[model samples]
Structure formats: C-alpha cells, structure tokens
Target: MIYRREIDGLRAAAVMPVILFHAGFSFFSGGFIGVDVFFVISGFLITSIILEEMRDGTFSLAAFYERRARRLLPALFLVVLCCLPFAWLWVMPEEFRAFSDSLIATSLSGANFLFWFKSGYFAPEAGEVPLLHIWSLAVEEQYYMFFPLLVMVMWKRKPSWMVAVLVAIACASLVYSEWASRVFPSANFYFLPSRAWEFLAGSICSLVQSKGQKRGSDPLSLLGFGMIAFSVFYFDETSPIPSTLAVVPVIGAMLVLLYARQGTWVSALLSTRVFTMIGQISYSAYLWHQPLFAFARIRSIDPPPLIVMGALACLSLMLAYLSWRFVEQPFRRGERRLLPSTRSLVASVSLVLAAFITFGIYGHDTRGIPWRLPAPIKEFMADNDWSKTCLLEGSSGWDAMPIENCIFNGSHAQTYAILGDSLASSLTPALTKRLDGMNIGLQQITHSFCAPVADVSMVPHQARDCGAFNAAAIEYLVKSKVKTVFLAASWKIFFEQSRYIFNGEEVATSDVGQRLRDAFDKTVGALTSAGIRVIIVYPHPRGDTEIAAKVAKLMHKGTPAPTITIAQDEFLQQSSPSYAYLDDPKDRHVLRVDPAKIFCGREAGRCDLARDGKTFISDKVHFTSAGAEAVADEILVALRQDDIMDGNGVAALSSD
Candidate 1:
C-alpha cells in the first residue's frame, strides 16, 4: 500500500479540533466530530490494505495482527505507563481505582464497554478521566477483530453481492444508532454497534475505488471539505450524533477519499508541509492530549484559566512529536528491535497484560490504596451513608406496586410520605428515625433527578420517565391517604440556568421554570383537596467548592484549613424565584420549611461549608449525615411550631 500525504493532512484536520475542544475552547463545541472523522479514515485505509492483500493472494491473519500490534501498542503502552506515577501522586483513592480499572480494560480492548457503564462521554467528570479517549480505539479494534474474517469469506464473490451485503450491514447499524441515540445515548456514543456505520461508510468508499470508480470532480472535493467544516463548526454536545446528522461528515470523508486525487485543490492543500507533519504525529497527539489536560484539571483547585490550558495543548503537541519520532517510528521500522520477532512481541504483550492485571487486582482489593493518605482525609473522602441502599434507582417508570423496602414500618396503620429527587432521599435517614420513634409510619417515594412536580419534564440527563414517576408518586400519596407529603429538590438548577439540553436541543430555562411552577401549583392543589398537608422544604445552601474533597486535599497537603464559603446574598438571589412560588402564607394546607436560614444565617453573611472541623456539604448540594440531621431538626421545630405535631413530638393525626 502506498502512503497518501493528503490522508495525513486530513488526520491533522481531525485531531486539532478535538484537542482545542478538550482544552476548554468554547468556540469549538462540535470538535468531538473529529472522532467520527478518524473512524472513517481508519476504515478506508484498513479495508484498502486488506483488499489489496486478498487480490494478491497473500493475506495472512497473523501478519495483519502483527502489523496492528506493532503500529498501536508501543505508544499506547508508553502513555499508560507514564500516567501511573502521576496518578499515584495526585489522584484520590476512588478515582485511582477507576483509572486502574481503565488500564486493564484498555489493554483488553474493552475500554468502550467499561465507560459505557460508568458515564456519558460529555459528562462533567469525564474531564477527570485520563484514558477516556481510548474508548474510540477500542471500538475500532473490536470491529477489526471480526471484520477481516468476514471480508475474507466474502472476497471470492461477485462485486455487486459484496456491496449489497456491506450496505445492508451499514444500514442496520445506522438505524440502530438513530434509535439508540434517543434512548440509550451513552451506550450509542461509546459502543461499536451504533458506530459501525461510520467505518462501513469508509469501507464502501474503499470497495468503490477498488471497482474502478471514476475520480470525484474537483467541485466535489471542495464540497466535501465544506461539509466537514460545517459539522466541525456547527455541531455541539446537544446534537443527536451517530444518527442521520452524522452522515454529513461520513459522506464528506468518503468524498475526499474518492474525489480528492493528485493535483486537486483539496489534495494539494492537505499535502502541504504543516498539515502533513501534524497528520504524521496525529495518533501520538490524540494519546498525549487527554492525560495532560486531565492531570492539569485534577491538580488545580479551580478550573484552569484559558491561557494555562492553551499552553498545555502546545506542550501535548511537542510531546506527541517526540513520541512519534522516537517511540512510534523506531518500533515501526524495527530499528529499536523492541519486537524484532513475533515471539518477542507476544512475550512483551503478555508481560504488559500480567502487569496491568496484577495492578488492577491490587487496586481493587486495597480499595484505591487508601493507606496512601492520612486517616482524616480518607474519612472525608468516603461517600455519604445515604447512598448505600436508601436511594431508589434503576427503574425509569414507576412500579405497578411499591417495593416493600420503599415503605418503612409496613405493619403500622398510619403512614406519611416523603417525596422528590435525591434531596428527599438524603433526608430519609433522619426523617425515618424520627418517625419510627414516634410510632408513625413513613413511606419514601424518591426518584433521582425527578422532581415531585406534576406534568413537568426535566432535561435529557435525567431519566426519561421522570414526568411519569412524579405522576405516580402523586397518585400514590392521594390514594394511600398519607397524612403529610414532604417535597425537596435542587430547584435552582432548573430555574436559574439560561438554558438546558432537552431531547438533544436547547430549551429556555424560563419555559422550564414556568412549567415547574404550573406543576407545583397543580400538585399542591390536588394534595390539599385530598385533605393532606404539604411541607415544602427549601433547598440547602450550595458552595462553589466540593467541600469534602477540598478538605481532604488540604489535610493531605498539611496546610491550614481555608474557609469554604458561599455568599448568602447570592444564594437568596438565585433561589428567590423558587421560594416565592412554594412559600404562600395564604394557602392553609401548605407549610413552608426554610432550612437555608439554619444552614446560612445573615449574621454569618456567608454560608460556611464546614462547621467545628467537620464538612457540612458532602458534595455541592446534598448534605452529609450530620447536615441532614441538622436540617431535620429544623423541620421538626417547624412542624411543632405550626401545630402539625404535638408537644410530645408525635403526629397530630385526625384519627388520634
């Protein structure tokens, strides 16, 4: 197979946007499309090579795999090995364990599956993952594992039959991708089944070229360039990718491969010195960029400034160039003699495999090596107790009948319900204990990210059946004749933002807020009409710092604790709309509980995240056990003062 200078230039085009986007440049929001571009290019080149080998009757699976190992493993292994020391020095125990898991997964070509279970590609914590980009490589490698054999079996057939088969497969993949992007989006993004069509698009191009198709016109080449540029600039995180919209870039890449021949403007420009050079080191550049940016984020107290991130991008390119020159080229040419024989290559791979497997076991068994940090820091880093089993998860729609565990003191005659998102779930530990002691039964009906509002839908990041979940909870509360319903959520998240991503498009926050307000009114009216009391719990104070993690970092550094705070004025200003809607003194059945006053007093001027050497806010919003207890105390006081509970702290039930 001959080298194509223009293909290398195209590689440069694919990589730079990804690096810039990951570096926090807001303008290149659609830079993630670069991965799609890479998939197409890989398919075209690999298929071209395979088809040529088959034509010459020299195709051998062993030779193909050996070449693949030589090309991919050296630089990848180096990158992972370089990450270890820094990971030990900086990463927390939980994250380090996750990193170790990724190391093993990447080695086995299963990183894509691992991440699919863990998180979405564009999630907030994704930036903290150094090896997240390896998912794409895993996808391609997994495809190649079966693709070559299939091609070999079909190579003897007529050209038309082969094309039809390939087209059929690609069409099935595209249809699945479209449906999955709407339903199981993270899996669609990370997994190969939904993404195989992009590669097949390139494979089709290779097949066409092999059948003596005419070169695409110069105008077609220019049009292909425009389409790719349009996608790079216009698409964003909200785009429903791997769907029909993705066909634009896939077709663009196909056009370039088929049409942009020698002397064409697209070919001449791509074959330029600068583009060709970056393309040459593109693989190393992709590998190097993520770790540098991720580590920088991990070490920083706040998000690194644009200038700092920009400098790190430059540093990644420099390192990539060095890696390509020394590590990648030497091994490819066998000049370094690292894998001079097939047996040596196998031995090296086995050693790497054993090392990563051992490390993974150690990390998993030791629980991220907690002994590395001081006891205080370790304790601080531990997850909140409420996350263990109290939170309801997994089901998107409401159960036909409530799970037995969801109802506490099932034998008791009188029941009260607690409802909302995780905020309400966190209050369970304190609320259940108090109610149990008083011989009053409690039923917890909480869904994560599902606000207990009627007929309102949250953003796509939440569960799809959130509106249904909320409706079911409301119906259950009314039908079961619960004495009181407690409502809680991170209300400001919906009302304060300018916009949110919903069903793969941006919707105005104001519209969502109005919907929430309408739902709140209808829900409250229904509950009150059914003769149940409604207690609307206001949101707790949130801070910019992740208090527990910051405290742990401070202890690790042996530095004096710095005060973590959020301005009371800012909190009030942001949450005022929610408070105004929920807190209506004129409504006889509705009682409002303001825990913010207890959490953030005006005398203090700002909310203090830590009290008496203990962190209060476990994460940004949800409370620690102690914090939950404090808020529950405030609720208890409010209930007694409002005559909803007796002097003995038992519920003032009508039956009693």
Candidate 2:
C-alpha cells in the first residue's frame, strides 16, 4: 500500500535483461527470469493493497478494476495501435493473421493461451512476433482476475485462513510446475496453472509483512540479491522454468521484499533516482521493445548488426519514457486525467476495446489485407507449392510419407530414399517430380528437426530424441534394401544453434564437434555397410533475416524487387562443420550435394535469395518449390556423373 522506490529500482533490474535477452544477447540467456521477478512484485503489491482495503472495509471490485484499467490498458492499446501501419507494410498474410490472432487475444487478456497453442515447431522466430511480450501481461491480468476473488472469499470466512489458503495453493502449483516443466514444457512456460506458484510466493511475502517485521537485516537482503544474480548468470534456456531451479529467484525476490528496508545497501542501491525512473517506465519499456525488435528484423534486408540492435534497444527506452508520460500518466495520475470518473473510464475503455477487437477481426478476416501489396510479391509467397507437400512438420517421427508416386524405379533390385529433417522433406516434392520423368521413384521419410544423424540428440529443444528418429529411418531403409539414401537437414542450425547430447550426458561444448564427427561416421557407416550409397544434402545457403518477409516489406515501401544476398564465404564459414565432415567423408562413396554452390555461385562471392527472377529460399534455410526443383536438377546431375544412376534414364517399375 506504500510506495517503495526500491521496488521500482527492482523493476529496473527485471526489465533491462528481458529487453537485452530478446535482442539476442547471449549473456542474458536467463533474462526471461525477469518476467518471474515481475510476477512476484505484482503479487506482493496487489495482495498487500487488497488485504489493506479489506481491513479498512473500503474494498470495491469496481474501483480495483478501474485502477487496473487505468494502469495497464491505455499504454497497451497505444502500442498495439502504433503496430498496425507497420504490420500492414511489413508482415506477410499468414504471419499477419497470426499477428491479428495475438492482437485479438491480447485485447481479450488471452494472449498467453493463444501463444501456447500457436508455439509449435513452426512458430515464427521471437524477433518476428511483434506482440509476443504481451503474453506476460496477459498472464498477470489472468492471475489478478482469479487471485483477488480467492483472497476475498478466504478473508470473509476467517482472516487467518487466507495465508494458509495461499500457501496450500502455492505448494500444489509448485508441484504441478515441476511435473509439467518436464512433460509439457511449452505449456508449462506459457500457461497460468504452472506459473501460479511464482505469484503465490509474493502473496505469502505480503502476509509475512502484514504480521510484523521481526528481523530485517542487510545480510538477508544481500543473500537475496546474491540469489537473483546467481540465477541470472548461472541458468540458461536449458533450465526447466519455475521448477525447483526457479524457486531460487522467487525466494530471492521474497527475501529482497522482506528485508531490503531503509538504510540497507541493497535498498539504497535499488532506491537510486535513475533506478526508480527506469522502474517507473519499465512497463512501457517492456511493451515497446518487442515490436521495435520484431519490426526491425522484419524490415531489414540483412540481420541488423548488434550496434544497430543496441541503438534500437535505447530507442525503446526513450519511447517508453514518452509513453509513460503521455499515454500512461494522464489516465492514472489525475492532474490532467482524461477519464476522471469510473463511468467515463468504463465507457472509454469499452469503446477502445470494441474498436481494437473490430480491427483484429477485420485484419484477420481480410488475411492481413493482401491487396495492400503488388500482386507479384503476393503471388511469390503464395506460389510455395512444396510447403504443402510431404512437410516434415506434417509427419510423425519415422512414419513413411505416402509418396509411393515418388519412389525410384530403376534397373536394379534396390531402390532409393530421402532422409533428414524438414529441409529434406522440402526437397522431396521437387526431387520426386524431377525423377518422375526419369522413372526413379524416391521414398520420402523425414521428421521436424530430426537431423539425419545417429546416436546424438539436441536435448533442450527435442521432445523426442532425433537419434531415435534417425535410427528408425536407417532400420526401415536397410530393411527395404534401399540402394542409395540422400541425407539432408539444416546442418548449420544443428552445428550452431542446438545443444547436443551423447549417451544421455550432455556433450561438453568443447566436445560437440568431436561428438558430431563420431555420429556422422556411425550414420554413414551403418548405411554403407548395408551396401547403400549415400549423398549428403548439405545445408542450403542461409540468409540472416527471414527473406520472404523482408522482400515483401521492401516492396510494400516501393523498393523495387529487393533481394537478400549473403556472401558465399560467410555461408561456408557458418556451415564449415557440415561441409568439412560430409564433403570428405571417410567412405569415398559417401557422396554430397551442395546447395551453397547452386544458390551462391552466380553473384561471384554472394548468394541471392532468388535466381533468374525466381524466389527460392523461403525463410532462412528452407526452400521454395522452385528452389527445391533446381536443387533436384543438381541431384540428378550428381547421380549421372557418379554413374550411380545410368545416363540412359528409362527403367521399368517394380512392386517388389
């Protein structure tokens, strides 16, 4: 119920790391914990206010809601409103619909659930999702919607039972968080059921303060600061959220609240003028940063440099200060308050809600307003035929895609198959059609993110082991007596973006290179031992930004047919591991296909997103149907030159 400059300073602590983390700073990989910190702060402040109001017999749900509305809604609505023109100019149709979905959900206080449902393997990258951060506000709003009611009910029945009720619910939520963190990690991360414990931790902290401060000391505050700092520096994305691992930060926040009193160094540090200012603007800072980052990525032709990203991060803070003053202050502070009464606030808020909801419905139903772009740019994205065919995301692991039409019909008893992750499946449709003329039926087998390797897994991201997926593919191929297998994946991603494991223990970061060497050797060995020929479909040329969206954004702004170009040397550097290992396999017959050569060779040192006015690379590494078809032509060339498939390409089909 009392203002604490230290708490505001604590807000400064929570918001900066989140902005930096979302800006792709690896040092702040655990920066997402800032949201949990915010949860604790919110629970404590809101609960303290409610309990105090109840004690004075002056609590009104209508008044409480009006305060929440004034505090949160106006600034949020302004941010969303500003994003509209940018979304119009930049975001592609399907992506725009998703943005619209978030818009509607955010307006309805359901963004967390929408995001959880939408966060599949194919979800857009965090930088491309403009309203992604709104999910946190949605979570907090949902918490308040229920938490106050529970507290009120408990207070009416018996004042002492409120603390007990909070404790019991918190314990149950903690247990659920631990169990769900392992089993339903995405759901656990986004939804309220698994996150209630973090809020309840703050609720209990409020109750303790109410009873009276017995032993507030600097040591406890220092320990709390130490715990918060430890979690921030020591934990990473691999850490299960809000599990026992998260209790450190939650309890740390509680300790800080309980003991960071006047005269304590921690309190003094948190109560600084700069920290309170940053804290005062923190909510607006959080709202503004995601859109700035997302739009910057969407609009840039190349990956925006770290310096540029840093500048944008600063710009967000500047914008936050303005938003806090102009949009947030007027609604809450009352000197020049636009809505001075609850009636006026309700009417104004309802109208804004209806207008935004209508905008969301209109934008979504119009499919992100396709008519806003030239037909050529619109057609270019719409013509993604391979995107609809034999996609890795469409398959359950190791299941044979019913592509009997694509099977290789050859002179020999053995047949052919394609294997890898989604990248492999992207090639299947184009490879299938290319070989159809040659009567070579190619069997299609792939899975999402399932690197076509053996005996290793990307432990943090993989729900099922990639090793198992590859194992099943190898077994099926061997049993089917396939003659040659073409292995493909986003090799650059596996080598760089993922964390690896061998034999159930994490492969040391230093040892990942050697572990991958061993895995590739085993994979090639198993197939080669079966008398099956192998062709490595090396990773395609990668663009720094999502290419299609970037091009569309440029075109909408009257830039003529812009393209994303990456240097060949840079591609090789990014993908050196895949190139070196797969290109010069120990087995001489372990052949390879290079997408970099096909995509990058034309521009001397640089690779273009399209060739001959045909767009190919879809996002970063995946291919368009036209691009896949071009790559298929190269595969055919390799087969003929290597004398694996005869130059005279006609053969009869065999059901055997």
| Candidate 2 off by > 4 Å | 20-31, 116-124, 175-185, 214-216, 222-241, 303-314, 333-351, 354-358, 361-367, 383-386, 390-425, 436-538, 551-592, 600-614, 642-656
**lDDT scores for all predictions?**
0.80, 0.80
Residue runs of model 1 more than 4 Å from their true location after superposition: 213-218, 334-336, 361-367, 383-389, 392-421, 430-485, 489-533, 542-546, 554-559, 565-589, 599-614, 644-656
Judged by lDDT against the true structure, how good is candidate 1? 0.80
Q: How many residue pairs clash in each candidate?
A: 0, 7
Could you give candidate 2's per-residue lDDT for residues 272-387 as a string of tens digits?
99999999999999999999998888777556888888998999999999999998998888576878988988888889888888888987898777777678778866674345
lDDT, candidate 2, residue 512? 81
Q: Candidate 2: minimum summed lDDT over ten consecutive residues — where? A: 647-656
Give the C-alpha miss distance for residue 638 in model 2, angstroms. 2.8
